[model samples]
Target: MDVAAIVTAILARQAVRDPATLRPGMRLDDLGIDSLGRVEVVFAIEEQFDLSVPFNANTPDAGGFDLTSVGSVIAAVEALLGEGRG
Candidate 1:
């Protein structure tokens, strides 16, 4: 599946708004996603990709991937999948 489209769908669900508004450069905070929302997004991504996404809901950078922006999340997923780890 297209990663961006999947992520956009997930974020749009959380946003409860139009998915078209989400941009690659938009940060999670800019997308209005809080800590709890972030966790949900991660969960969706993991389930969609059928791969475990490393994410620290308590401390974002402790032992996980980056969730800075939509593009970043997409990149991380691509990297993992490319490495055959996902």
Candidate 2:
């Protein structure tokens, strides 16, 4: 369940090409992701990571979660897991 694999699953779930590379700063819009696509990605991530991530379109920071990029999503997942350990 490393970041790269998570990223790959996300892209696969979204039906997007696994690009040659990815990183934290890449914006979702830059990847051609729309609102619905982002929701699908969230579901895929929930299934893959077995975590319920809360998001609010009206309040972007409600869950302090940021899925703007593969790396950011990975970071959020990692942070959640870390919190569970505490």
Candidate 3:
């Protein structure tokens, strides 16, 4: 699966208010994703890719996964796939 496309799909599914507002450089908050939505997004990614994502929903800054922007999620997934995790 394409990294950006997968991430974007998950984001669109989890977004609370505006899925169409999703963009590569857009921040998660600006895209209408709340904390619960962030966790759901990660879970969906893990399920879709069949790979574990290093994420800490309660303390996101402590994790390796990037939940900052759509681009960041795409980048992190690309890195993981490069490592043969997906």
- Greater lDDT among 2 and 3 belongs to 3
Best by TM-score: 1
Ranking by lDDT: 3, 1, 2
Candidate structures ordered by TM-score, highest first: 1, 3, 2
TM-score of every prediction relative to native: 0.86, 0.78, 0.85
**Which residue pairs clash in candidate 2?**
none
Q: Write the per-residue lDDT of candidate 3 for residues 1-86, one digit (tens) a residue.
A: 66787788788877753445678998899777889888888889899998888888777978788889999999988898888844
Selected candidate, larger lDDT, 1 vs 2:
1
Could you give candidate 2's per-residue lDDT for residues 1-86 as a string of tens digits? 47567765685457476555555677777777777787888787778778777876666567788867767777887888777778
Considering only N, C-alpha and C atoms within 3 Å, which residue pairs clash in candidate 3? none
In candidate 1, stretches whose alpha carbon ends up further than 4 angstroms from where it belongs are: none
Candidate 3 residues lying further than 4 Å off, grouped into runs, are 16-21
lDDT of 3: 0.83
